[model samples]
Structures are given as C-alpha cells and as structure tokens.
Target: MESEMIVIHAENAPMPGISKPGPHQRYRHPVISVEKRRLGALHADEIRVQMIYAGLCGTDVHLMESDPQTGYIRSSAPANIPETGRVIGHEGIGKVLAVGKNVRHLSEGAVVTFESIIVCHYCDVCRKGQFNQCRNAKLLGLEKDGIFGKVVDVPAMLAHDVTPIIQTDQDLQAIACVEPAGVAYVACRNTRVTGGDVVVIFGGGPIGVFAAMLCKTIFGASSVSIVEPVSFRRSFAAQWADHVYDVEAFFANMPECIDVVIEASGDLQNINRIFRNVNANGRIALLARSGTSLVLDAMDHMITNAISIIGSRGHLCGAFNDIISLYKQGRLPLHQVVTHILDGTDGFMRLVGAIDSVLYENCKVLIRFASANGRS
Candidate 1:
C-alpha cells in the first residue's frame, strides 16, 4: 500500500509595510506550510528517505533572520518569499523508506546520510573531480525541497550508506554532522596541512571546531588553537583544540610563523589578524559563507609574505564517505560536538524562533524526529 505524504509549497507573499533598499528584505516568519499529498513513485535513480534527525545549522538561523548577507536566505526567493516553500534544512541523517527499481546499492530500512548538493556530472568542474565547484549545482534545501520534512526524494547517488559507522541510533544521529565535517575536511585539504605544523582556526562554531579536529587528528598538527569571543563556545572548543583563547587573549600572545590558518569566523577583522600572524609562504584557507567582503593588505601579506589565500566552498560529496570511514575507525568524534538535541515538531519550531540566540552557546543542535524505539 502507498503511504500518504504532505507537500508544503510556499506561495509568493510579501509582508505589509516593509520595503528593502537592498536585494534582501526581512520576512517576519519562517516560510513553511504543510499541504496534503500522496507519496509519489521515485525516479529510476532516486530513493525515498524518512528523516530521523535533522541538524539545525547557523545558515538556518540566518535564513530565519532574513539576514541580507547570508547566502541561502538572500537567494531563497526573488523577493522575500520562497517559490516552493519546500521544507528548510540541508543537514540530516535518514532511513531509506523505499528505493526505485534502478537503485542498486541501497535498500529499504537502510540508514544513510545525504550530500546536500546534487551536481550535474556534465559540468567541466565535475568532470575534473571538483564537484564542489560544479558549474551547475542543484542545492537540496535552496534550489529544491530540503530534508526537514518527514520524507524526501533524493538521488540514490547522493545518499551514502552509514551502516558501517552507526552502531546505534545515537551514532546515526551524529551522522547528521557528516556534512559539516566534510566541509571542514575540504578546508583542511586546501591548506595542505602537514605533520608537526601549527594550525590556528578562527571562530568556535561547529565548522571551526570540526576543522580543528581534522587538523589535529587527521593532519597531525602539532598544535591546534581557536580564537573565539563567546565564553561558552570558547569553553566548548577546548575539547577539540589544544588551546582556546578569547579574541583579545589570542591577539596578545599571537604565535609567530604559523604553518596554516583557517578563517571560519566570517568576521572581516580576522583577515588582517591573519596577515600579522601567518608566516611567509603559509597557506590561509577562507571557509566562511557569511556574505561579507574583505580588503587584504597586498604589500605586507601577499607580495612580501607570499601567503596563499585559498577560497574554499562546499565539500566534494564523496568526502562524506571518507568521514564515515574515519568515524567507524574512531577518529572523527562528531558526537562530541553535538551540544543539544530537541525532539519532535514543537521542538523544531522552538529552535527556529530561538536559534540566533543559541548559536553563541551551542556547538551543534539536532532535531530528533524519531523516538528511541523508531516511532515518530
């Protein structure tokens, strides 16, 4: 028997008495609606997944705020409202509810984590194995419906099997973080971290912490440090980074001849600070998506120091597989970064309303859609 599904579509509607000078406009509420529909058959290469846990990201908070500078929210709608009103989330781990006839590697009831971006294999970048920079990329949450809802239809290739890493449902929940971990891995790859090098990460957010973990655990950095402003995040970062410093404290005793620097804060001031600290020929990887711009000191940093500034975007989807393998080997401690888990739909709304405030204190927040016994 076919199951029933609810498909929420957002219509074009602007708030009253609000006009924006820039391209971004403030929307008072989250743009989501629930509509009734029957579960449709999957495409030959697609799979139907029932979401178990969806992680709330900083990007979601920016979307809720209608932050004019955030990438996904600013581009969410032509004006202020979304066209599809699709469920809003990009990071999740789910169980395969059904698989299409042509789906070869996956089976119903199998647990998986999906890569949020579905790239066109025909693109030049994708052909060269740089799918992260694919010319034509269709994002799951932004360009299409996301995985926040009960069930989602995803390309079978985008879903990676997590059975190897997941020992219990709790481990499956941690898989919701594989996306950010992959992004951090890409940033570390950009910096070309080597053993015994000193690495510094700016910001104490989930990405910042995960980048620090990869630098220490995978790249074998001699020392990993974090520069964060918030006391709560600074304390949380201590578990992963060897040294956690408040911004002022870090600047006071800033290390010299740093091997690699990762700027994940999205704060423009970090660039200048990087210039002062990074050694000649050291690599600095910019990993933030905050729609902010920066002006670099060319003479002192670029020409004289010969510092290489690498702009890193999303991860190669295949990187998720590597992350899962590492997690299975007990190298990636994703669960350590999960600070809170809110259960059910009401919990989801509560997060949407208070996410901006929570970002200062929490590392990663997961919304548990299913109970421990697998009931929703």
Candidate 2:
C-alpha cells in the first residue's frame, strides 16, 4: 500500500469568477490521493511522474475567486462545469516512476520538471522556434490535466532531466522552485541590463524580488531601486536593492530618469508609474500577465522620450540550466527568498490565501510537497 497510486477526479467546478471566497475548496472541491501500479505507458507519449512538490501560482488565485474568467482556465475549460474534470497546477517538480516506450531524454527514476505551455509544432511560431509566442499554445494544467496529481504522465519533450540538479536530495521541494526562478531568468534577459545602469523594480512580489536580486547580482547595476508598497516584499527587495521604498517614497527619491524598469505586478496603473519615473531613453521589462483593458498615452510614451517596453513571456529554452548555474555558482541565493512552505494536501488554497496576505503584507511564499514514501 505504500506505493499505491490513485486518480482523483472533479466532475463539476464553477467558473473562477463565480467561485466564492477561494480556489482550494471550491470549484467542485479537488481531492489528492494515490494508487499502486506499474506506472508505465499511462498515456500516449505520457510517462508516469511521481509528484513531489507543486507550487500554487498567483494565476491560480485569479482563476479561483477573482472576477472575470480569464487566464489559463478560462481559455481551456468550459465556463460551466457540467463539461469535464478540471486539473489545475503547472509549477510542479517530480520524479519519473516509469516511461512509455517512445519516451526519450528521460527514463524511469529521473527527477524532472517542465513549463506548462505546450505548442503544436505545426504552428508558425513553433516552426520559427518562437514556441513561447505560438498562437496555438495549449497550457498544461489549463488546457488539459495538470501536475497536481500524485502520478502524472507528462510529455517527454517538456520534462527536462532535473535529477542532476539535486545537489542534496534531502530538500526536494525547494528544488521545485526552479520553475519560478526560471521565469525570472527569462524576464531579465529580455533587455541588456548591465553594470552602472539605474533600474527601478515595481511589484515587490516574488518575481519582482527576484528581478531586483538578479539585477543586483548578475548585472551589478550602479543602483538597483525597488518600488513596492507592501512591507514583506519590500524587505525582500531591501536585502538586494541599494534603495527600497514604498511607491510614494520611491517617486520622491528618484530622478525623472531610470535606465531600466521591471514590473512584476499585473496592475495596469504601474505602467503609468514606470512611464513617469524612468528617463527619456530607458528600457521597461514587464513580467506581469494583464487581463483588463489598459489605456496608454501614445504621444507621451512612444514619441517623446522614446521608451521601450517589452512583454516578458514564460521561460526560454536553456533557461533552467542558466538558473541552476546561478544557484550553483552562488550568484542567486534562492534559499533566502523562500518565506513559507505549505503541504501538498491543501497547498493550493493555502498558497492562494498566502499570496493575498502578502499582497497586503508584502512577502513571497511557495508550496512544498514530499511523499510518505521514504527517500530512496
């Protein structure tokens, strides 16, 4: 019974907009369980994966209780749930218990993780190696079943062998965080950030905090300044930035010019602030995923100072390797950034609640999951 695996199902889940209060216990109420099996060839090109830890994302929160059904779930799932089961969660790290016959780049017992966006090779973007921007992208947990399940069958192409990453296997769940860090890595690379550049970072969330940390560590910026109103996240920024302040203080202290601005909070209002705070010629690297309509002043933003804002997508290929190298080389101190770790049982709900608390409190949190099966 120790290795027993099971599949839990959700027949009906209300739209995130309609779900009251939170995401964990709502939307038909998801359940976590286990079953015992050979764990091979569960689906075509699907290799069974034993999930160790999966982080609950802010997007999951928006899908859980926020208004307007947008994001991954709204894009893939039926607005109403008389339709089919909904499996949610994308930032998951686990071990492969077995592999399908056709599987390559991975094998049974390999530790692995992957991005959620699955692109059809036939798409024009995929054909051009811009799969991240593919029009036909199908998100994993959003479009189909996600990695929240104890044992999942993942496409081999997406699952990179992460076993070599475990410097010490004792802390398996901490390694799961590589996915979010990978996100930060990809965002920072969008522009040429280097030493002596004055930068402003908005949205003291995990992404924003990492952006500040990376800008400090990798780029050696002359002065990395972060603008966030939250206390906890502001502290995270404090550890890295030469100057960290609330929105008001950030404006009061800054000149009318910054070299680069990284915005992690999805609030459209932040855009106006970035435009106001940065120098005439500057770069704006945005990591936020926005949904609501945003109004822009074309003349002020585009024509005058000639500012450039680049929208950051998910990880690029080789990004995970780059993040790992940073960690190994002591460039990124990922351990200090982890503020909270919750269990897999109620991880999603708990994490969503924490994110909301941090929005007000200003800190970062991650979910950590481990098996009852003793470490091998």
Candidate 3:
C-alpha cells in the first residue's frame, strides 16, 4: 500500500503568525500538497533521497514545541537555497535516487550524508568560513523542510560525499547520527585536547555520551566522569565514561578536579556545577542548543582559575570525516550510541510528541523513508 503524499513548508518559512513550527505543525504542514503541486516538475538540484535513517536530535524536539509567539525570525533565507523551501535534515543519510542537471558529485545509488547547516554563501560569516553562523543560515530540519518525509530535495552544496564512509545502506542509515556526532567531534577539536587528562562531562544525552566516548577514543583521557541524575541515562552513559554519577554527587566526588569539562546537558544547574569541578587552566566547551540560558560566576572562575569556555553552535559537518576515520579504525563504538529504527512517519511523530524518558532509553532512534519517486 502506498502512503499518503505530504506537503511540507520550505525551510525558515514561518506560517504567517507562527514564528516557529512545533509537533502540531507536523500534522498541519502537509508535504502532500507541495508534492501534488510539482508532481512532475524537476527540482533543479533535487536528488530525491531514500531516507535510510535519520537520528532524533534535541533541537528537533525543541522545534516541535516551539511557540511562534516567542520565536524570533531571521532577516533572510540561506544563499544556497535560491528557493526558500529547503529540506532540513542535517542528520540525514541516504541513497541518491535521481539527479538534476549539472549535479556531478552524486550518483543514483551512492549512499551519502551531510550536515544540515545550509548557509547563504554571500553572508559575511560564510565568507569568513563560519557558515554555521552565517547571517542567513537556514539549517536543515530547522529553517526549512526537513528529511522526515519519504522524498526530499536537498541543496546540492549542502550534501556531502558520504560514499567512502557509508558502506551498506544500513550503515548509511545510521550515519544520520553523524551530524551531532560531528558536533561532539568539533567541540572536542576546538578545545585542542591532545595531552593526557581527566575530563568531566555534564548531561547524559546522546551528545553527552558521544563526548565521553571520544574522550576515551580520541584523547585517551585517564579518567572520565559524567554528571547525570537519570538512572537509565546514567547507567547507559556509564558504559562509555569511567565513572557516571548523579549531578548532585559532583560536590562529593574527589578527583582533584578535571583537566577538561564538556557541557552537553543544557541544564543551567548542571552547567554551574561543571565549573566547580574543572581544574584551573582547564577548557570547557558549551555545546547546548539555542535558548539555553546560564548565569555563571565568570569573574570568579575566569579570574581566579583562568578557565577557557568555548561556545559551539552547529557542528562542522567536517567532523563527519573524523567520525568516519574513527569508525574505520574501529576506535569508536557507534552502535552503543545509536538506538531504535522506525519507519519515517511513525518515528518522526513519536520523537516530536511522545519522547519521555522510557522512550529514549535507547541511545539513538532513527527513521527511514522511501525514495523520492515513491519507491522503496
């Protein structure tokens, strides 16, 4: 049986009064209508992706609940997307089904992936190689149409060469997590963590686990400690970290302080406690999403201890290469971090509406979609 066609909004396009779309909008924004309108028209750079797998991200949940009243609008759309409605799936990986004119990088069956941060190349930030912060950044799945559907046309430039890293269609599918993993990879890289050290990490979410895992695989930290209150998440995160304890337990743990602190959890209280555990002259990279707020004793910490805090937004898809290298070397265990695989529609909706603790006990949850031409 064929599924109903869906009509989705282009990226960054707010529905009149709504500043941002939420889970309700998923039911409201019909991708079927858009497909019906251009039933047969060729999308210029469209290479209908058979969404093998896409990971569930925290930002996706926030966007699902976003209140338009409180949401802020950007000044312009991304440059690469001359057209306004770009599909947003920064964590998407799939096979290229059909290609438009002049698109040479991909082929019909090549398994590929990319980060969803599509930027307006003309923006100053983009010109400075900071495309993630481009004045006109239209993130995949955030600003435009996302990869939750069976068929989505992504901007050509936004797509990366995933041929070498993605081996099987299944592996290509799990690569959806590559985007956020790239985030952890980039955050750690920015810290330039090379020497042996002890690391403290906050949050036990997927990103938190990835951060801890890399601390083991990439930096080979002597001791890794994670601060998390959730029992399941803590137990799950403990598999990777040397010691996983309650967030409140931080005051008691005695390790003489850590060399680095990676704050993956967006909770302000966790952020505050993380500062207390970091050794003077240590580095802390903040990798939470937008709208997360924290009031820290900067003068006390910075002046007294000389701590360096680096704020990172949007992972450079470049980390996909690094993640790929780690996977090939058999250094990182991606299977532990990835969980649940659902058919696109159900998975997409469940992630939006019913993501409670019990649901996300698994490390990663992925969604699979059909080919653009409506073929599996």
Candidate 4:
C-alpha cells in the first residue's frame, strides 16, 4: 500500500515554510492516508513506482466518453471508475519507490517508464515467443486501475530506466512518448519497411508522426508523407515528415504507387483508400482502432497488387530499449512531439478533450503530477 500526506485545516494553525509540501513542513506534519489498489499484488518480480508524470492516450479518451449501453470498453473490471474511482492514465514515467527482493536489475529511486500491456510469459502464445499475442493479456488502464494516482505497482520486466537518456526536463517530459514511439516502431517492422523505400502514413497524430520519424531515422526510408485534414497537425507533422498533405491533396498529388502505407488514424475512409494507393509488392500495416468495419476489394486490390495487409497491435518489449538508445544518440526527435502539458488536476478533462478528435489538435498531452520538489 501507498500513502499520501494531506494538510489538515484548523483555526490558528501555523503554515509551513517548506519549499514543497511533503517532508519539509515546519509546523505539524501532514496526515498520511493509505491508498487502495483495485487489484492486489506485490509479486516477487513487481516494483512500486511513485508516478511523477503520465501521458494521456487516445484510448483513455475513448473510455471517458464511451456509452454505457453500447459497452465500447470490454473488460473484466469497470474501466470508467475502477476501485478508487480516481483519475486513470496509462502512459507514465516515474521513480521506483520499492522493488521486490527477487527483482535483479532495478532498484529504489530509479527513474523509469513501463509497458502498459501486462503479458503472462508462461502462456502458450508467450512460449511461442509471440508475447504480444498472449491469450491472457491485461492492459493497465483498461483491465485494472492505472498510474493516474501518485503510485502504481507493475511487473519489473515492463519497467525501463530512463535516467541515463533523460538529461533535461524536456527529455523527462518525452519519456512518456517512448511507449508510443515503440508502437510506431512495431508498426514499421510489421510492414517490413526497408532502406530507400517510399512511405505514406495516414493520420498526422502522435503515432503517425512517430511512424514517419521512425521510417526515416530507424527504417531508413527514402521519403515520408503524412495525410491529415487538420492544418495544425499537418504543420506540426511537417517538422518531421518529408511532405504533409490534407486528405484531398493526398489523393490529388499521391505518387503513382506508394512502397508502404501505414494506417494510424483509425479513420474508416482512410483505411479503405490504402488499397488503391499501394504499389505492387508493397505492404500495409494497420495500427488504428475503430468501432466501424471497413470493406476492401481483396481480390482486385490486394491479390492483383500483391500488397500484404498486416495488423499491428502492440509493441515488442525490446522496442523500448531500441528507441531509448536511438533517442540517447540524438537520432530521434521525440521531444518535439509533446504539444501540451497540463497540471494533474486537469488531466482527466484534457484527456477527454483530446479524445474528441476534432476539438483539439494534440500530438501528445502530458500530465505533470509533481514537480522536482514533490509539490503537486
């Protein structure tokens, strides 16, 4: 269990002269309250983290506004309001408060970020070396309460230390982005992107921009273009993508054939359009999430063009280490992806706004839970 200090209100009580609220109270110390975990665990391989920053994902937004009647979120636990009914956020970066005795490489006070998908390594799929396809997978924020609160306990294998690569405050802010970058890396790997190949990504969102960057930096693609209707997002994407075009402009000025197409927007229409745009022997990686299904001409478009359609769901565990190494080497421009930073108080509302899709032009929104001094 974790505890939080709360200042008591009383008449004639002296205020503290501390710089931050936690340990430096000059007068009476704040009261400590026990934090409850929805799912109980302190496994030998688990580590407890005191979350300092958490990034808001599109999926977080989906859960916020999902209709109860339709049941868009399918999970064993209540996604909307888990055990504590507190704020829920998945993409997180924090300090290791405690590590179980069996944990080897990690220690207390280490700055780290973790993978959201908790995979059961002993499962049949995991035994096949396909951990991403684990039959009994539970997502952090989806199946249980997430790291929106001040503390979270997660499996040590999912945690990666960011202290070596994160030098400045900006670098620390970008740690939350590493997870999504890994997602894009997996998408590009699924498409079998190679050097000197032309890539077109649909969606100028964070994942799309990250995919574009990964194509040029990691995959060594010859050129990359992004298709998005939002001018703000297009301009932001232009900083990384070789070319940025709106949906109509993408259709008007598209190349005769695209070597690779990555669908990251989850827009049904954009997904269907990939069939006519991909070149012969090209590959399409679908990384989008949508409620509606898209119909495509499989025989005429896929078979005739020899285009391989693949769906990429989650990132491989090693991808995080790879992306962090690249970032440390100054190869990836991850810091440029975060456009908005919010105080922890407004994280839930801002995440809801980000999910609306049309309401906000967000690349990445981060929630600052506590400062370096431990003040909220």
Candidate 5:
C-alpha cells in the first residue's frame, strides 16, 4: 500500500490583462496548489526522507513566475517545464526513514540535506570535475519532483549526511540552508578573496549576507561592506558587514575604493555603475540569475584598469561538506541570517504569502514541518 502526503504544486498560467508576448509583456504568476500525492516504491539507489524544514529561495519565486511563452523560469536557462505541475523546493533537511539496498553510506534515521543539482556523471563537464556545470544537470525543484513534499525519495549520492554535525536545532536550520550558502561559498572562492582585501557586496539578501559573513570569518577579509536599497535588508546586513549603506550613500563616498565586488542582487539597472567603484586590478563575482541582458559600457575602463568579472553558478559538490564542517566548528553564525520560520502545516497559501512578502522585510524564511515543532 502507498502512503499519501501533502506536496506543494506549481504550474504556469497566463497573466491577467495580457494576451501575447511583447515589450511590456508581464508573465503570469504560477498557479500554486496543495495536493496529496501517493508515494511509489523507492528506487535501488535512493533513500526515503521525511522533510523537517525547507527554505524558501529566490529561485523558487522565479520558478513560480516563469515566462509564459517559453514555459521556462525567466532569466534562467536549460530548465524544462514539466507538462504536469511539479513539486517545488530544494533546500531542505530531513530524517532518513528507509534506505535502498544499494545505498551503503546512509541508513535509516540519519539526518541529511541534499545537493539540489542532480548531475549526470557521464557528462563531459562532470568528467572534468565541474559537476555544477554538468551539461545534463537537472535541478531538483525545476526538472524533477522536489522536497516540498512531506516525504521524498532522494538519490543516495546526492544526500549529505549531516547527522554527525548537528548538535542543536539551529544546526539543523543552518543545514537546511546549506544549499544557498554553498552558492555564496562558491562565489567567494571563485573571486579568490584573501586576507586584508576590502570587499563590497551588492544586495543584502541571504546569499549576499552569507557572502559577507564568509568574507569576514572564513576568508579573513579586512573589511566587508553591503550596498542594499531596502532599509529592512540593510538592517539585517549590518549584523554581518563592517558597513551597510543604501544605494545613494554607498556611491557618495566609496567609489574606487573596493578591492572586490560580489553582485548578489540581480538588479541590472545599477550593475553598470558598480564598475566605477572597483580599484584597478580588482575582481567582481556575479552570482545572480537574470533573463535580461547586461549592458556594460565600461569595457574601456575595465580593460585599462585590469579589472576581472567572473560569473559564478551553483555550488560545487564539495561546498556542502565544507559548509557543514564550518557549521560543526561553530565558525558560521547563521542564526542571524534566518529572519522568519513559518509552519509548513499551515498549508499552501501561507507559504505563498510568505514568498510574496519576503522582499520587504524577510531574509531567509523557512517552513518547519510538524515533526520539528518542539525540537528547537
């Protein structure tokens, strides 16, 4: 007999007041519904997990607002839209309930979190040890059934057993967020931030905040600053960065002083101006995904100054383990980053409302399952 479980489902629908794609075409919001799904037999290389907590990501919001014409999430490439609505979410932690016969490393009752990108090991990029950029990579929430369900069967190789490092409920919360924080970790690593380097990060979202935290604690940067337009986010960023400034305040006095710039905000409008703030021989890492084309008119200046711009994608496979180690050492103060934790049992609309309202005041919102209610 199959067990029934609740899952969040996402599907595309046409935007109101718009008929066809044009210059001002506004994409419709994804039709979200809460439904019960019946689970089938677990695969040989998979482990069944009962989710405890799941983080709401910007990518989730993007997937919820996919382009009507292409059926793809706007600004993101190589993602397919399933003909039927799909379960949505990737960043989460859970307890293992059962393990496949072939899964030797993990067993029942182990605490685990997953690598969101399911890579095809035979791909050329995977053979080159660039698994994150696998040509045949399938994103968990985007291309397959994801962890939004109460129970999910995950590939054994993709599951990271965090049971050893989890000392407190806070640790579990941080582990749930490891997927996004790992992205920030890769961003900082890709830029090669060293001790004494002065860094400025654009945007004060969770990834931006994580980058700032890693720059200070792990990389030993001399100073880290955050430039964000939202006052609420600025307040949150102030806890991790040396200085937090609104857009105008940042530009007035800090031009040409930064050694590194990490762009975590996908705000293309102000991206061009950030080039003017980097000192000669400086580096910038872009971590955001946007559909719009970036127009950089500062190519001449960039060439003359010897500045480098790097594009960073998802986290490398090792990043998850590295972040888990940092958490074990208690070096990462992740408690400050999670601003809201809502009840997953509250149903689908509450989750949707939280996602909709995250822009104004929330930073790193999480949904807690019933099992996690009294733990910590």
Candidate 6:
C-alpha cells in the first residue's frame, strides 16, 4: 500500500544569499524542507517502521551546515551532499508495522532501534567480526535514506528488537539514544577504564557526559573530571563527573594525576596539554572527529611516560546490545541526556532553531513524530 509521509530533506546546495562563516562559526545552514513524499516499496530483507522518536546528532548538524564551497560535511568521514539531497537522521526508535517475506527475527508491533552503519557481510572486515570497519559500509542518513520521517523501510538485519527492555515511555526515549551512547561506550571500553583510575574527559557534550557517567558508574573509575568552556554544559556534567572545570580553570589548576584521558572535544589546542596531565602509563582515547590537521608538541612526554593514544571510530554491533542491557539493569540513566523534545508538527524551522541553540541551551534534542501516540 502506497502512502504519503512527512520527511525532512537536506538540500545539496547552500541556502540562498547566506555567505560562509569564519572558522568554527556556523556555515550557511543547508536548505532543509519538511514535505510529504510517497513511500517506497519494502525490499525482501527490509521491514516497515513507524518512527516514534529521533535524536539529533552532531553528524546531522555538520551535514546541515556543510561547507558552502565544497558541500562536504566534516564528520567521522568526509561526505559530499548527494545531488538529490538526502534524509538527515540516524539515531531513533520505532515500532515495526510490517515485515518483508525474507525477514525472520522481528515481527509486527515490535519496538525497535537500528544501527546506523549498514555493513556488507561479505566484506573481509565483516568476516573477521569487525563489522564496524567493513570496507563497503553505507551510513544511513548520509549515503542512503534515513529514519527522519514518519515511516521508513529498514533492513531487518540492522534493526534490533528492543521491545523486551522498554518498560516505560522513558525507556523508549533512552533506547533512541543508544547510538550516541554506544560511541561513548566503545571509547571507555577501548581505554580500559577500571577501578582506581582517575579519568578526565575534555568535552562535556553528550558523548563526554556519557563517558564520564560510564567512568564513574559502570567502569569503576575512582574520579572523573570534565573540562568544558560552556558553563551550561559544565553544570550539566557536574552531576556525573567528580569535578567540572572550565577550560581556563582546568589549565590554571592543571594536575598531573590523571590515569586516563578521553578527548571528546575536537579542539586540537589541547593535544599537548593532555599529554602533560596524564600519569605514566596512562591511556588516551580520541572520540571526536575533526577535519583540521592536529599539531602536537608533547611527543617526548608521551614516549617517556609510556602513554598510549588510541583512535576510536564508530560503535560496534555489540555496543547496542550492551547499552540496552545496561539500561535494562537501571545502571544507565540515558534519559537524563535529553534536554529538549520538539514536536515534529512544528516543522523544519523549529528543528533548525533547536540545532542553533544546542551550543548554549541544549544537550540532546529529540523530535517526536506526530503519530507517536498511536501505535499499531
């Protein structure tokens, strides 16, 4: 049955008449329109989903404000806006309404969430169980259609049945956040944050906050400190971090006692300073994505101290299940990360406004679909 659905489409071209901004400033906001479009047919391995809630991610914002001249987004990978534009969202949860004949795991009326990366199982990396690094992976919302609309067709393999763990509306909300939370989980897991470790996170954004929370509540870190320049973010992170410091205050009171460092902020100026703060044999995990070249002057410090630096990319397949398990156990308070929930009926302008206010006013913003209240 063909039906019309509302979708948020990101335009490939820049917004008319807006000049590009200086570095670190917002670029010409990409042209996004909320319009009704006909739904496509479901493939044999796909399932039809009715989106309930979708989280706004940093990648989405980068794609929306892509470089005007190149039309490229600076994120985990460099991607140019497709000529036909694209649907712009990845983190979300929904209810399954129909399953294709080839689908076996999920069923109708099942609540579910999805992994953003669609990997080819035949790839060499996938054969070795490193599906996250699959050579031919396609990122949803960027390389293909995303789940920003009221209804979407998702590959059954990429959808996880989260119905068992969702006991409340809040649980449903937290499940929508599993994607970003998984990124933080992988960072902390790779760094091996354990008991007695004094960890420090360089950014207090959603990822940094999640890392800090895991360090203290899940990973057993003795002390977790967060450094952020935004006062609102610092205040928000104080609940999870043992201490929160503004960039100036953090440098002024620099202590060489950290056992692990997680760089969630893409600010390159702190590269050298991070080496100085860690104790000997400390581990550092880089979680942020940046297009600019990073310059460091603390090579000697890193070598002499035996510090290991690790670069973490996207989350693995297991991360989503692990996060869902944690949430089921009540160990993860993922709901706290959501600061704003805008109704989709407000349209594209409201979403753009919410994105603009993120730097100062919001932590995690969600768009609730108008049909969310009526489930199959």
* Full-model lDDT for every candidate: 0.75, 0.64, 0.64, 0.72, 0.78, 0.79
TM-score of 6: 0.89
Q: What lDDT tens digits, residue by residue, belong to model 6 across residues 1-376?
A: 5432333333344445648622223223356766555666779899998888888888777655655565544453434345455666788899998999999899999989988888999988999998878899888886777888778888888899998887777887899999989999999988999999999899998899999988999999998999998889999889999999999898888666889889988886776766777898999888787755567788888899899888877777599989889988989999999988877636445767556677677788887873445442
**Order of candidate numbers by TM-score, starting with the best:** 6, 5, 1, 4, 2, 3
Misplaced by over 4 Å in model 3 are 1-40, 66-89, 164-170, 290-292, 350-353, 357-360, 370-376
Residue 167's lDDT within candidate 6 is: 77
Residue pairs clashing, model 4: none
Could you tell me the TM-score of candidate 4? 0.83
TM-scores vs. true structure, each candidate? 0.87, 0.81, 0.80, 0.83, 0.89, 0.89
Poorest 10 consecutive residues by lDDT, candidate 2: 71-80
What lDDT is reached at residue 7 by model 4? Answer: 12
lDDT of 5 at 224: 95
Per-residue C-alpha lDDT of model 3 across residues 1-376, encoded as one tens digit per residue: 1222222342434456756643333222222122322325447776666666667676554433434563332212222222334343457776776777868887777766767776788977788887667787767765666665565666676677666765555555546677877788887876666658888877788888888888887877888888877787888888898899986676576477778878877666565655666778888888774444577765686668888888876766367778877776778767567666666565455544455633346666766665423355
- Per-residue lDDT value at 174 in model 3: 47
Q: How many backbone overlaps does candidate 2 show?
A: 11
Output the better candidate (1/2) by TM-score: 1
Output the TM-score of candidate 5. Answer: 0.89
Off by over 4 Å in 2: 1-41, 68-82, 169-171, 298-301, 347-355, 358-364, 371-376
Tens digits of per-residue lDDT for model 5, 97-126: 899989999989899999888888998889
**Candidate 4 lDDT (Cα, 0 to 1):** 0.72
lDDT of 5: 0.78
